[model samples]
Target: MTRIPDQPKRLRIVPISKLAAAPKWQLETLRALREPVFFWFTAGQGRITLGGSTRGVHPHNAIYIPPGTMYGFQAMTRTQGVALHMGDPTGLDLPETPLHLRLRDGSQHAEVAQIMDAIQRELEGAKDFAERAARHQIGLLAIWLERQRSSAGDDSPRGLSSTNANERLTARYSTLLERSFGSALNVGDYAQALGVTPTHLTRACRASCGRTALQLVQERRLYEARRLLSETDVPVQDIARNLGFSTPGYFSRAFSAHTGTAPSLYRKARGA
Candidate 1:
């Protein structure tokens, strides 16, 4: 005769009691290949069995599992946190980062629970800006988890470094572009950081990324300009200056060239 252990009904909510009850209602669901499932545990601990190993992922711990990475999880005990089911995920669109978090002491439980509570509210109510709010919180949670893990003296799971010199140079350049695109906006400066000549940097970037270093700089700047245009109420000339363009005319011309529309017109068309 075959034996089947009693399991909690599918998608049933379990009440919070003590730590031992955490795994009482362990549930498993085979999500789609590209689903974004964000996990947070603020109450009890649990074992996350993934990739043929059972690892403990507890409170203040978070990870972003890439698509096609076979994994499953169960609670350590009956605990509460946000289990966000991200919608329509394209693998590259998500952050390629995993987070491990820890608390200073008992005091951090409240803070962690607060963050999860906010996410839970957004998930439950389904408000107009819930998705936006949840995304913002997720970014914040990622940052917070990294800091917590660093403080706890665990930094083992960062992404692999780029393979070649050109790839390394491009990665560093991309980081600098993200930080300074709004002000310094210079490919030469990024090259200086990499201890390489501008020509070499341009060649490396072109070979590895199929674009010149300057083109990457312009691309990032233009990207920021477009984001601000579509999301904020800033003036056009100010946006140009903010993006480090020398003049409004130059910015307008560059924007037109890249996007085939004036910044203002583009924003207007998008109903920003």
Candidate 2:
């Protein structure tokens, strides 16, 4: 028998509705990804918190998030969009920061839609060199994003600015949390590392994203626990230990409180 090699993971588009089908915590909780993502909304409205800043989004809004940035959103209405997951943008000329552009001009919207359509077709087809063709289309999309950012000039999203002290501090805290969420570090320990008192750190977090520092830390840990439970067959007790919970009972209680389901039950429900 001839051996077949596994196919490399290619970029793909996910409809916003399908993404919403996931558990609410998976979408609404503060978490970070290892790959960059771009969201293009065609209808409805929502408020998204990215890098400790919350902003409203509506139809024809394009939001770009770089890898390792914490973000979450609440869809106030029926949201409609597609998310492009760009895996390992090692050499792409993409933005290093987040962008939320409201493309008001109909022409601009059409241009983006066209590029996305091309990429989608290439991904769905089995034609020769489809991945390469899709990558070229991604390049075009990157250029479009650059042009939109330049044209927006001063009218760009305010959340992208790092001038605010609270936002900057919260951003740093988010980075540290992403790196060390698995450790047994509490909010006080993190505050000490950042050279701020726990009270001041919580205040800054609330001012920036409406969540206290402790809440952010717990949310990130729960997010990881949920991911591990749903995606792996690892033992529940082992998961608790790996996530820094002092005891399996405590971990189960925390998971149930946040998700309304115990960790073992959650994994069974996910068919893992």
* Residue 241 miss distance in model 1 (angstroms): 0.6
Per-residue lDDT tens digits for candidate 2, residues 53-136, read 777888898888888888998764578989998876877788888888877789988999999899889989979999888888
Clashing pairs in 2: none
Per-candidate TM equals: 0.47, 0.90
The clash number for model 2 is 0
Residue range with the least summed lDDT across 10 consecutive positions in model 1 = 4-13
Error of model 1, residue 60, in angstroms: 23
